[model samples]
Target: MLRVFRHYIPGITFVVIALDVSIVSATASLAGALGSWPGGGALWPKAACLVAVVLLCLYLADLYRLERHGRRELSARLLSALLSAAVITAAIGYAVPAFRFGRLAFGQTFLLLTVALGAWRSVWVTLDPGQRLRKRVLVLGVGPDAAQIVALRATGAQPYDVLGFLDDAPEAPERVPNGCELLGKSRDLLSLVDELRPDLVLVALADMRRSFP
Candidate 1:
């Protein structure tokens, strides 16, 4: 981990930051090419400004930190960061026309940035070959109570990341699950909590009969 301004961050994090910079810059260029940026000097300076401001907003939102986050949770944070960037960038451009890239251009760039970043993150979360990118979760039970969670996760609408299910009587057919992989019996609860330090342990068992571990 590298210490960035007293904040310890993994070296790989910088690569993501660099990618974000490129995305923002490209968005600005695309906007300018659309003839929306009028009377502009070279657009690079203006693009750089956008990149810096947006990056700062992302930093403030702690987006650079690698953590377990579901799509909805991650999207909320991204939306907040972009909103802050929009405000700060608009103010900077307004106070100094020299940095202004025109209203239409800025709007178009901002919109593009939003769409691009959102799409980028969707792929980022999905392409987790290591299965460690998303938030880690353990479902305590796989009964009727846990059905909603399973369904939500299946549709990728759940805010909290649910890795799998835990049942005392683990079945062979995915362990009485709705597309949720059965991790293990609840008896080994202590050992099962080893991976990625699960962010949440949800006890959603419909029936806690004698089989409860």
Candidate 2:
């Protein structure tokens, strides 16, 4: 998770934002050059400003909060953000003519940014679930203690991927929720760690007094 402005954003979402900003800025510069806007050397600053405005619009529209909105909702939000950014850009251009790229360049840049950002986000959504960037967690017990972690997962409160439980008690019933894998005894910790490669191992043993190797 990436924290910005006290808000926790998913890592993938942050990557998307970075990509969008880069693409938007590039598109703006390209549009300016194609339209033959004056001050060719100084055009980059204008392009950067345009991208900043668009990103601010997107932030206001909650585009950065990936978990809160579904694809359809996100698309609608993006459209609204683009429209808002365009309006704000037009207003700024009207008030400060020196900062304005011509109408042709502005239109081209807006259209390109909309398409680029939308396509990028579409691909991100499609691939995000299969990405291994999310932390994988291994629970070290299968008793009531471990059940709490499973409960948290069931409630969707813990975002980490669970790699399931481990226990050494041969007679202990499966106390973890159904569908969660019980990946053998505690004695197999090293081998399991090697095979699973979990980002975190949570010790929730019922008998903490027992010496664990």
Candidate 3:
């Protein structure tokens, strides 16, 4: 779950705040249509306050925390936050008697809020900055450990600059399973990486002794 939250939670808060702004704006615009309660002239102020309340509630729920959660758990948390926001909004509107927000506006706000939040998440996934920052790297092995780094780069998880591989055993494949070059033997790593000046140097040699071997 930490993985999921670390990757998504801040951006989720950003999206939620955006959606809340839209919902509150919509509610304020249609306050009269919804049946304005007693102290109704200050619609915008009340709407702004409602938005603030939603944000506070989200924070209190720990919805904006950067803790990770499984996909199912994250979804449940999101759903609960949404429901809680709606309930709180309704309850406050009732108690204030001055904030006359209506049912049609409520429906519109909630529906639009969901769409806005989902869109923000989609945008975040599409525009992941790690993908944009292409860093070069050279792995020091052709074995299982090195292979995992290659897989991670290919999957767009870790931004790496894999210039190629440096295998000591000549008979060991000349190319990595993921197709980076077998630049040379393990002894040549420092020189190769120095020349490459890659953003990172991942020593994925299965045997730690082979790092300098």
lDDT of each: 0.73, 0.73, 0.60
lDDT of 3 by residue, 1-213 (tens): 112422212234566567657765665565445564414446675577667776776566555532323334545665676678788877887887555456666666656555555455445445564533566676776777666677787567555646677777666573467455666778776776665555666676666774556
For every model shown, the clashing-pair count is 0, 0, 8
Select the stronger candidate by lDDT from 1 and 3: 1
User: What does candidate 2's lDDT look like per residue over 85-170, in tens digits?
Assistant: 99998887777765677767888888888898888777766767433235578888766766567667535644676777778777
Model 1 scores a C-alpha lDDT of 0.73
Score candidate 1 by TM-score against the native: 0.59
- For TM-score, candidate 1 versus 3, the one ahead is 1
Candidate 2 off by > 4 Å: 2-9, 36-41, 129-213
lDDT of 2: 0.73
lDDT of 1 by residue, 1-213 (tens): 354553334467789898999999889889878888533576777888889999998888877654655678778889999989988888887887767778888789889988998888778878863344444568887776666776565356444566667776545334455555566677756665763256788886657676566
Which 10-residue window in model 1 sums to the lowest lDDT?
1-10
Residue pairs with colliding backbones in model 3 are 1-68, 1-69, 2-68, 5-68, 135-161, 136-161, 137-161, 137-162
Ranking by lDDT: 2, 1, 3
Model 1: residues >4 Å from true position, as ranges? Answer: 3-7, 129-213
